[model samples]
Target: MNKALPMSGVRDSTYIPENILSVPPNLSMEAAMKETEEVIFGAIVSVLAKTKVECSEIGILIVNCTLFDPIPSLTSNEGIV
Candidate 1:
């Protein structure tokens, strides 16, 4: 959270996992997936709203995530472009 660090200009309101802030941080796959979904969905909604683009207008979507690739994938799970 140090502003002096590179790429540390993240907003104060950014969503951070509770476990990450805990005294002894624990890794939670569930928490990570939830955060990922929130971030990706939020970005999609924001872009669509800003561009005034309809969901149906989107022909293809390429989601690239290295860490947590689900079996159904986000696109398949949501059924949304």
Candidate 2:
């Protein structure tokens, strides 16, 4: 809370703990993979809910990530198509 400290520049709209400006020391490959699965599955479900498209109706799936390409691939991890 001291003005002498550099923390005064922090933005009111920004959350320091939740933001990913710097990776946490405990971050690991397993955690990254779990997050990837959650993201992929959540997005697929969101699209299906909006479009009213059945899961079986989906013929092909494509995945694109900035810096993540797991061993089995992203879509394959979903397993439900």
Candidate 3:
């Protein structure tokens, strides 16, 4: 069975320019969630392409995040499944 594994990567704050502080923090949680989902899905697609796995063949997907826990849910896998 094919599997999709979602892994985490680190972003360096040093890459941000000094003038970035001028930007407003008008970020919505929904926007953040959509961006994150797109990123994760892209990563999964890349891995699947490299491994010759079909989308329909996927049996499971595993994701791990340190922050942003779901309310009343110990693990996020429940939402994915």
List lDDT for all candidates, in order: 0.71, 0.65, 0.53
The true-structure Cα RMSD of candidate 3 reads: 11.5
CA lDDT, candidate 2, residue 1: 57
- Each prediction's number of clashing residue pairs: 0, 0, 0
The best candidate by lDDT is 1
Tens digit of lDDT per residue, candidate 3, span 7-76? 3332443332223333674355454454456656778889988999898997766665444344543334
- Please report the TM-score between candidate 3 and the true structure: 0.52
Give the poorly placed runs of model 2, Cα more than 4 Å off: 1-23, 76-81
Model 1, 12-72: lDDT tens digits are 6865667577777656767666767767788989999999999999988788776556677
Task: List the candidates' TM-scores in order.
Answer: 0.58, 0.58, 0.52
**Candidate closer to the true structure by TM-score (higher is better), 1 or 3:** 1
Please give the lDDT score for candidate 2.
0.65
Model 2 TM-score on a 0 to 1 scale: 0.58
Cα RMSDs of all predictions?
4.4, 6.7, 11.5
